[model samples]
Target: MVSIKKGSLYIVATPIGHLQDLSPRAQSILREVDFIAAEDTRHSRHLLNHFGITTPLQSLHEHNERFKSPVLLQRLHDGESMALISDAGTPLISDPGGFLIQAAHAMQLNIIAIPGPSALISALSVAGFSADRFVFEGFLPAKSGARQQRLKKLLEESRTLVFYEAPHRIFDCLNDLVQIFGEKREAVLVKELTKVFETVYRDTLSGLFDWLNARAERQKGEFVIVVQGAQFDNKAIDPKTERIFWLLRQELSLKKAAKLASEITGVSKNTLYQFALDSKNV
Candidate 1:
């Protein structure tokens, strides 16, 4: 039972990649609002201009969001309804303005959402991975060691894993993922989604890394990585691991077989070694 104020703050969504995806409701709201708070004035200018939306615009991004929150809150308090939009997609999602929204809520001011496109949702739509359960990891650590450690943490995750990466960091990031998650893990790489030169590639982790490395041009756009969920089984070990252990046992000692299996499967070598010893005892 939320009351609608005559001059409410409207949180609108713009297009993530395609300008045409901008909803008519979003366009109308942009045109009708007393003012609009945008993440990037220049980027939003192009969008507003394309639709002939001439509403007064104000900047509200990471650099100035803190100082501007109070001012925007004051405007809303004064019964001046405005619309908040990001350079692309919805606001407060890897964008700024979380504090301002909370402030508005506290004041009991009318708040509304004009939904449209989101990059995360857009990428997931074409990823072709299991969507029943997924985790949206906005961005990875910029450093090498930290990033690899994070990927290692998700090695056993049973749900699909999604991540956003900048163009400059894509190659190195993918390299680290292959090292941590194993070369055979399946992954889908979606780039510049919905925009020209958009590409969706589904392949093994090593293959995607090789493809990106071979083509310098392929590394220029924003990227989304969707990794297949881990398969779970219990019969002492997975079929894949059991087969590897069996093959290695034929040529190597029990300790060496476990080490080889652990390296190949990214499992614990000690655990595999104990299993191998138990099998020998049997």
Candidate 2:
């Protein structure tokens, strides 16, 4: 029998899609915990039913987590162990229950993490990009303007970029990526990961966009977009060129400054613009 200590909070990772992906330890913890706190009781019940695990569940989503954290913490203090789970994948990764975990730490309560399936890690493993270093942006802003601004901020990121997108906004997100990152930038779109209809499309930004449009069903699943970082030789800009570029940027807009600096120094305008963006000198 798996021994679950009392007065401890177990952070369990549920399967993102496939039910079998839930580890034996996670199942044991879930079955043995006093009760489970889930983002959605109904959704989690289904998973529990499949495994024949009859452990009771309580709701702890974004809207009510603030109010419920104390209540759950008190239960822990009363010697009741609990497991926290999101609707899918790991809890608190683009999901709720962060406040509860933080409170647990502050209260000096025991917290254990049972790691399992994560969409971010699953997508990155097969992305074939630089896995050594990467950034997980989670979900971007819903509105186009805010989303574009966020992408613009990461325009010069050299490490791989990972993001999650809903089915409805996948098209617009990919469009903005193409516009900001350029058509030829390499990217991978992993959809409905670990499920029967899983699809992994790898190509340039424009090519991925076209590939999605070519098949309507391709756009109808949870999406994980992995983008290759900007390829630029920062050392290519000599001190003389950088000095002139900074001086021009102060006097004119980024476009005009990059153009004038490029013409004067014989450096690429794109490189100058990227430099300005990275240094925030523009």
Candidate 3:
């Protein structure tokens, strides 16, 4: 029999898509806990029914987490063990239930994590990119302007970048990526992961955009996009050239400034353009 410690909060990771991905230990903990705190009780009920786990569930989503956390903490203080689960994957990874966990820590309550599948990790595993160093940007801003602005900041990041994107915005996201990061930047798009129609496409940003546009059916699932990081140049920008560019930028349009600076400093136009982009981000 699985042991449940009194007054403990178990942070369990559920499967993202494939039901079989749920670990045996996670199943044991879920069945043994007094009650489960789920992001959506109705959605979670299906998962529970599959495993014949009848543990009671309480909703603890973003809207009501603040109000619900106190009550949950009191129950834990009174020695009721609970498990926190999201609709999919791990709780609090671009999901809700963070407040309850934070409250548990502040009170010095017993807390444990039951590791399992994560879409981020799964996508990275098959992304065919350098995973030695990477950044998990849970999701990008919904609006184009804000999303592009955020992408601009990440343009110079040397580490691989991972992001979760919705089906509807996948096309738009790719378009922006091609425009900002350039058409030839290597990237991978994994959709409907671990599902019957799972698809993985590895191509340049522009090529992926064109491929997705070929079939409407391809746009219909949760997407994990892995993008290769910018290749950093070994040669540093000359101090005088950068100073001249900034001084010109103050008085002229960025394009005009970069153009004139390139000519005056005998620097490549592409290098000066990139320098201007980095400066604006700063």
Give the lowest summed-lDDT range of ten residues in model 1.
273-282
User: How much is 189 displaced in model 1, in angstroms?
Assistant: 0.5
lDDT of 2 at 281: 50
Q: Against the unseen true structure, what C-alpha lDDT does each candidate score?
A: 0.85, 0.93, 0.89
Better by TM-score, candidate 3 or 1: 3
Better of 2 and 3 by lDDT: 2
lDDT of 1 by residue, 1-282 (tens): 123345699999998788999887778788877899998899899989999989899999888988998888888888887999998777887789898888888888889998888878877788888787788888999999999889888876667899989999999999999999899999999998779999999999999999999999999998989988765443558889988888888888887887788899977765665465446641
> What tens-digit string does per-residue lDDT give for candidate 2 at 1-282?
489999999999999999999999999999999999999999999999999999989999999999999999999999999999999998999999889988999999999999999999999999999898899999999999999999998887777999999999999999999888889999999999999999888999999999998988888999999999878887999999999988987889899998999999998887888777678655
Model 2 lDDT on a 0 to 1 scale? 0.93
Q: Which stretches of candidate 3 lie over 4 Å from their true place?
A: 235-282
lDDT of 1: 0.85
Which residue pairs come into collision in candidate 2? none
Order the numbered candidates by TM-score, best leading: 2, 3, 1
Clashes of each: 0, 0, 0
Q: Indicate the residue-level lDDT of 26 in model 1.
A: 79
